[model samples]
Target chain A: EPEVTQTPSHQVTQMGQEVILRCVPISNHLYFYWYRQILGQKVEFLVSFYNNEISEKSEIFDDQFSVERPDGSNFTLKIRSTKLEDSAMYFCASSGQGVTYEQYFGPGTRLTVT
Target chain B: AQRVTQPEKLLSVFKGAPVELKCNYSYSGSPELFWYVQYSRQRLQLLLRHISRESIKGFTADLNKGETSFHLKKPFAQEEDSAMYYCALSGRGSARQLTFGSGTQLTVLP
Candidate 1:
């Protein structure tokens, strides 16, 4: 079975620096999403992408956050000027066009902004 | 606006015993509920959804609109059932982004 894959399972970066987390969603899926889980907190949705544009986003997705499908297979979440509160485990997920609600998640990338 | 609540932060059950993970939601409109499970060091996977009304891996959940609950139940718990379970809700229309509850970590002892 195909699975969503993410790069740099663990990322440690200095505060105020820009970081881009990468994900390769399962091929043929149409919808892609980014969610984050802070320590001991529930997973929160950040943004959703479809048709090469953002379909929806949460309040947590502020001006500092941006998502792009730079290529056919890669979905990237870039955080400009990271803050300490931004430290969390970021997960990438995708679902096929047929079942938009059934999302398959990638092993999360743990980001620590020092 | 939309929120999911899993009251119990942690639960424990012996192998062969029954287990229940409680979940409640607050939504004005008809809600779409789902249960996602994360095994140790693994990604979150869909266990089941209320719309499907199907049982997966010996687990089942029924959505009760009156009570606004979608509690996950298992008749016989196995040791492998130990994992973190999250209850999520999706709103109507195209976005369908999930709003998850604080997960319940279940430990099934052998």
Candidate 2:
């Protein structure tokens, strides 16, 4: 089965530095999403992207966050200035055009901020 | 506001025992409920959806709109059933993002 793939399974970055978490969603999916889980916490939605624009975003997705589908396969979540609170495991997900609600998640990327 | 609540943080049962993982939700309109699971070191994946009314891995969940609950149940628990379970809810409107419960850790001892 095709699965969503995320790069840099683990990353450590300094506070205030810019970081980008990349994801390659399922090839045929039309909707992409980003979610984060602070250690021991429930996964929280960050944003969803479709049609080269953000379809929805949570309050946690503030000015520091931006998402882009730089190419056909790459969906990225960039944080302009990382904060300590930003340290968490980020998951990428995708689903077919009509059934986007049923998302398939990737093996999250663990981001640690120092 | 919409929310999902899984009261129990952890549950442990012996093999061959029946298991129940509770889940409750708060939503006004018709809600779509799902139970997702994550095995150790693995990605979160869908275990079953209330809409399908199907069982997966001996697990089943029934959506009770009146009580606003979708509790997962398994007739005979197996050791391999140990994992993290999350209950999620989606509203009827557009762009209905899922709201998940805190999750329950189920451990089926051998």
Candidate 3:
């Protein structure tokens, strides 16, 4: 079965540096989402992207966070300035349409902001 | 606030044993519930949804709106069923955004 794929399975960065997590959603899927889980915490939603725009966002996704669909296949989450608390497992997911609620998630990228 | 809660952090059972993973949710209006599973070294994937009303891989979950619970159950636990199980909930007539539980780690010892 086709699945969402993410690059850089793990990322390490300085506290003040920027990091971009990349994801390639399944072809033919429309809705894309970003979620994260801090170690030992529940997975939290970050943002949802559709039609090249954001549909929803959580408080954790502040100004430092931005998502872009630079290409037909790539969806990226960019953090302008990382904080220690930013370390977490970032997951990318996609669904076929808005009517359907099922989402397929990628393996996730472990981000560590030291 | 929307929330999903899985009370058990870990559950261990022997092969052929019955297993139940409990999930509870707090949502005001109509709710949609789902169970997702993640095997070791595998991506999280949808196991089953309450709306489907169908069983998958011998696992089934029934949504109890009266009790705000959706518990996953399987009559016989197989080693392959050992994985991290997460319960999720979404509200009706709104965004499909999901609120997930902390998750339950199911281990079926051979």
Candidate 4:
């Protein structure tokens, strides 16, 4: 089965540096999303992207966070000035059209800011 | 606001025993519910959705709107069923962003 794929399974960055997490969602899917999970915490939604624009975002997805579909296959999330609290497992998901379709998740990228 | 609650942090059952994982949601509008499972060293994957109303791998879940719950159940559990299960909900829209619960780790002991 085709699955969502993410790059840089694990990343370590300085507190003030910028980090970009990349994901390649299923080719035919139209909707994409980004979620994060702090260690020992529930998964939290960050943002959703469709048609090269953001559909919705949470409070956690502030000005420091940005998402881009620079190409047809690549979706990337960039965090400027990463904070210690920003360390978490970031997951990317995609789903086909329909209200009942299930979203498929990627393996996730573990971001560690020190 | 939409929220999902999975009260049990951990649950264990012996092989061949029945299993149930509880989930509850709070949403003003009609919401979509789903169960996602992640095995050790594997990525999170969809197990079942309320809309399908079908069983997968001998497991089934009923969406109880009256109780505001969607509990996953299996009559006879197997060792392979051990994994982390999450209850999630999405509001009625195109965003399709999910709000997930803390999750329940189920261990099926042999």
Backbone collisions counted per model: 0, 0, 0, 0
Interface RMSD in Å per candidate, to 1 decimal? 0.5, 1.1, 1.3, 0.6
Worst 10 residues of 1 chain A by lDDT: A94-103
Candidate 3 — what's its lDDT?
0.92
Q: Rate the local accuracy (lDDT) of all candidates.
A: 0.95, 0.91, 0.92, 0.95
What residue pairs clash in candidate 4, if any at all?
A: none
Error of 4 at B6 (Å): 0.5
* TM-score for each predicted model, relative to the true structure: 0.98, 0.97, 0.97, 0.98
Position A32, candidate 1: lDDT: 96
The parts of candidate 2 lying over 4 Å away from their true place are A99-101
lDDT of 2: 0.91
DockQ per model, Cα: 0.94, 0.72, 0.73, 0.91
Candidate 3 CAPRI classification by DockQ: medium
TM-score of 1: 0.98
Task: Please give the lDDT score at residue A6 for candidate 2.
Answer: 98
TM-score-wise, the better of 1 and 3 is 1
lDDT of 1 by residue, A1-114 (tens): 999999889999999999999999999889999999999899999999999999999999999999999989999999999999999999999988655559999999999999
TM-score of chain B of 3: 0.97
**Candidate whose DockQ is highest:** 1
Per-residue accuracy of model 4 over B1-110 as CA lDDT, tens digit each: 88899999999999999999999999998998999999998999999999989899999999999999999999999999999999999898888889999999999999
What is the Cα-based lDDT of residue B64 in candidate 4? 98
Ranking according to DockQ, highest score first: 1, 4, 3, 2
